[model samples]
Target chain A: MKVQISGLCKKYDGKPVLNIDNLTFEQGRIHVIIGPNGSGKSTLVNIISGLEKADHGTVAYGSNQKRFEEVRGSITLVMQHPYLFNTTVFSNIAYGLRCRGADKKQTELLVKEAAEKVNLSAFLTRKAATLSGGEMQRVALARALVLKPELLLLDEATANLDPESIGIIERVIRDFQTATGATVVFITHNIFQARRIAERVYLMMGGRIIEEGSKEKTFGNPESRITREFLRGELIF
Target chain B: MDNITNGFFGALELILSGNREVYGIIGLSLVVSFVSVIISMFFSVPLGIVIGMNRFPFRKAVIMIINTLMGLPPVIAGLVVYLLLSRSGPLGYLRMLHTPQAMVIAQVLLVSPIIIGVTLAGVKDRGNLIQKTAFTLGANRCQALWTIIKECRTSIGASLVAGYGRAISEVGAVMLVGGNIKGHTRVMTTAIVLETNMGNFDQAIAIGIVLLVLFFILNILLQKYQGA
Candidate 1:
């Protein structure tokens, strides 16, 4: 699904944290937003996924121009330090289906499918509270992926994962992208990861999108000075 | 020494023989406290959750009020209920004075604040994460509340158990409102009081034993639910 934002502004404690004049995110491609710490990348994604509100302007989703509440179920965001419900992994994965009133058979089938996709089939019956850190992140991924959200937002969801876990998650994410072809908004500080996964790139510094373009043009052949410095790891905010 | 020994043995006998008076008191105590806690929860649990989850004007003041009421003297509560149900009081026309209904009212008044206070603490401690998680997973407001309730089930159960303990072991409020009417309003705690006042220490000890057993079972159930 396509989303367009214009004249968006968000402030905290009477100071502007995000002040985007205009931005558009298109459908069916993995988009990566890269920035330094406190550069409002997470804030922007949160605004997109309707987790946090923008003080000014609007976020128009898809062709219908649906507001957040109207299409909230179709958008899923798995944040950094993801929280799993104090329940079995299977139940956690099935939660979205259950909330939508899916039947027992459908819930079981879909939950198992999602669990297998994340390679968590063996942990379905285990209590979510007992899982390790990386396993918890996988459960969170399974939970979000099970719903097959039309717009999936990942806000540094794998920031501290082990390399092996990160590799697994990246593979699963690739598999999902190929299968559903849904719009994926990825936020990360890892330039290597951005290079590997980004189909398009947006660079933000000081709460503004200084430059945005396709991956090759944005990262490989940088245009803006800030973008070039960021690519060289010298643009520390 | 002989009196205490005899009282213990007599209590065992009364319990083993299922003495009707003792059993009736035990039954009435359980019924009144159980019903009162159940009704109180319908109002208190939600109140606690709302107060805990949201930020509003005077929230700290409301929390202070609940905390103060948690330590409300049972006698003051009993006196207040007595005035309300007495002949010259506002609710006197209901003619519920000296009845089990009045006892239930007093117990509810005493128990609700305790439940609300404990439950509020539980919600404040762990409500937000589960709620945010549920919302991101596509749960609506009602569903989010249900998920928070499920996540905090252990603390909620403990809160209810605390209320139960306070209600069943209470003496002043139930005694004042119930007027200690035999075979009708007499509960375990009130009966213990009346029997001891009349120098019938054996039956008092016996009833106390039964009360202990009931408390033990209830706490066991609470612990199991908490651990689950």
Candidate 2:
């Protein structure tokens, strides 16, 4: 889905946190949003996913420009610190399908496929609480992926994951996009990771998008000075 | 020593002989308390989930009221119910006093706040995280709230046990509203009290033993149901 945000603003305790005049995410692309810790990336995604309300602005999705409520079932978000339900991994992964009223046979098939994609088929019967951090993250990913969302939002999903886990996640993201033509918005702090996976890059600072372009243009020849400093690791944020 | 021995033997004899009156009292106690807990659940579970999961005007005030009522005295609850069901009172036309239904009503008044308070505490502890996770996974508001209730099942089960413990073990409210009529409103606790006051120590101790054993057995059943 192509998502557009216009005149967006958010505040916490009367202190402005995010302000975006206009931003567009093209359909079927990996759009990486890179920013430092307090840059409102998470907040923006929360509003986009309709988990939170923006103080001002409109976030519209798809060709019809449907609001978040109208298209909520087609959007899914994986959080930075994902909460796996206190049950078997199979149940957690099958939760979304159950919510959508998928039948038992179809849910079982899709959950297995999702677990296989994330290399978690062996852990399906195990309790979710017993998994290590990386395993838990994979469970979260499988849980989201089984739903086949049109818009997938990852908020620092692989921040502290091991290289093997990261590789599996990146491969899953790539494969999912190729297979479904879905829009994937990845939020991260590591610039090189962005370079590796982002087809389009959005650099945000202090609640605003400082620069955005294709990966090569933004990384090699940026228009904004702050973007250059950010790329060079000299900016303090 | 002799009374204790006699009471122990009397309890065994009552069970083995299938004493109808003793069995009836036990049955009535279980029925009244279980029905009260079920009625309390119908109100407390949904209200607790809603109040615990959302922020609205006077939420703090409402929670404070429920917490205060969690410690509400059973005698006070009985007195209120008694007055309300009296002929001159507002609900006199229901004609529900001195009956099992009256006992159930009084116990409901005593137990609802406890379930509500514990539920609120449980929801406040982990409800937000569960609700947010459910929402991000494409659950609607009702679905998300239901997920929170399910995920917090441990605490909710604790609340149920607590409410049942209070209802089954209590003597004040039931005695006041039930009137301890023979073959009618007489429950185990009231039977024990009447026997003790009338110097029938063996019978009182036998009834007390039955009460503890019944509670233990029911507790195990409830836990099993919760696990399932």
Which numbered prediction scores highest in DockQ against the true structure?
A: 2
Tell me the tens digit of each residue's lDDT in model 1 across B78-191.
999999999999999999999999999999999999999888898896787778788888999999999988888877888899899999999999989999999999999989
Clashes of each: 0, 0
Evaluate all candidate structures by whole-model CA lDDT and list the values in order. 0.89, 0.90
Evaluated at residue B127, the lDDT of candidate 1 is 85
Ten-residue segment with the worst summed lDDT in candidate 1 chain A? Answer: A228-237
Clash list (residue pairs), candidate 2: none
Docking class of 2: medium
After superposition, the stretches of candidate 1 with alpha carbons farther than 4 Å from their true spots are A234-237, B219-228
Off by over 4 Å in 2: A234-237, B215-228
